[model samples]
Target: MTDMASAHLSHDPKWTRAHSIFSAPSEGADVALIGIPAHEVSLSATSAHQTPGAIRDALARYSTYSSAHDVDLRDFSLCDLGDVDSPDHESGEKKVATAVANVRANHKLLIALGGDNSITYSVAAGMWPDLSKIGLITLDAHHDLRDGVSNGSPVWRLIQAGLSGKNIVQIGISDFANSREYSQRAKDAGIHVVTRDVLRKRPMADVMAEALDIAGAGGREIYVDLDVDVCDRAVVPACPASVPGGISADELRQAAFLAGADARVRAIDITEIDATLDTPDQRTVRLAALLVLEGACGVASRKN
Candidate 1:
């Protein structure tokens, strides 16, 4: 009780390295982080648009050192490209596409923080001129093969836009999150589906190895779509559709690390988190921030 308030110290720049302070894209860097804070067509709430800013603030709490990957994030180059202005769905997708093209041209790796899962279509479409040369993997609870233009339909949209279903591999599809018709659509398109039940039976590393093999076949560049809804509800309170009994927080972070470690993984999208809906502690936003750094660790491990 001896003047505790007077003993408080400010956040030191040397000790607090926030993600927002990452260098600009014009300066050139190994990874380009773009924020697509557009949720015009999200199935859940509209405030997902606040995720990018919240995550940047949350990133200030964590150190850059990654003990698991044995990589210091301070050594890696990351350009924070800032957020895109997409007031509507069409404009959002178009803006994201243009930004992604610029990021792909300048950065070795592209990591997009999403307003929703719909950004996946824009990111993947923008990254590769020809879909045949690309492989897509989604770690999501839903198949996302719905009919309309919303968070629930990026996969269908990507397929319609020339992405070959054979090159897409979906993991962690939980029960009650998908429908029989979408399942048939995946099968019809030859999209590989690895159920959560199946995932539980095997180690994530093993499952990821097989997924990467399918998605990276014929030396294709991979784009990973990480929908936070694939995580357990407790970990991602901001993800409206996330259910119980899903992948653990550590497992999702490990997935991001593994995806980044592969040179074939050209880009990744971390989606479906609405900062406004997050708990008072901002756990969801913090996790998303860590995932971005974990992706950087993956890039560090990749061969030039």
Candidate 2:
């Protein structure tokens, strides 16, 4: 990972724009962004820990293509705190918790670049210390309300950790093949399920506002977790349990826009990028990179 990260222009004269916001708190700089490369996990996206490096590479090209980020990552205060080196999956929960705790402690909004959905559990565990009430806004094709580990089933574990089901506002549940029991568990627990049908019917803007209201119910620590599979397979690819009719990039971006606009949202994660399913040239990392930029810009705009 170090080798790949070194290959990128994390620090280059022309890329000074990206570095302007990439300041470090260790340097006494108030960094608004903390890129956590959490790659050790049980799901496909967890492998994305290694992908942020690729995203950096892609960002260099993208920023050069557009004069926007070249103007100092859009003039945002950010930093790449680097990845959490966790090798074992069984111990992943602990490692991610530590990494996220550090990010939270730094007072930087965590842009958790993932390896899988499992990392969300660790991120939540870490942020639990500072968060009094938390709301989960999960944008996925499937409702990950399982009770145990079954491929990409970290959301269930997150709920088990006491993240109130009622506080969760699940959007773009384009598919829910789990079971009636699973649906009842989340519903019984008070989790709000905003189906794609409903989302399409209602104003996306109002839906976000309502989601925020639900998420804000506890106290406020909005965790946005996105599994690439949640997106239309056309935009991405197949995952553990694949599905059709996923959310579009624009929809996800709009959601990111909402999350970023909502000051209560403290942490965000864009997970599940299968480079194997990328372009013919293997450039799938752009999706994640663009997602991060959208998330960052959203936060930057909201904070302003």
TM-score of each: 0.93, 0.81
Instruction: Please provide, for model 2 over 1-304, each residue's C-alpha lDDT reduced to its tens digit, 9 standing for 90 to 100.
Output: 2355346445555554342345444532233444445544454443455565666555543452223323224455566666667623657556666655665556546777666666666677677863336888887766777656633566777777677777888887764655788777778878898877786677767888898888887567688886666667666652434356766767776777577657778778776664444665443466666666666666656545
Off by over 4 Å in 2: 1-49, 64-74, 87-90, 130-132, 238-242, 281-284
> Which residue segments of model 1 deviate by more than 4 Å?
1-21
lDDT of 1: 0.84
- Cα lDDT of model 1 by residue, 57-85, tens digit: 77776778777768777787877888988
lDDT of each: 0.84, 0.63
Backbone clash numbers for all candidates listed: 0, 7
Instruction: Give the TM-score comparing model 2 with the true structure, all chains together.
Output: 0.81
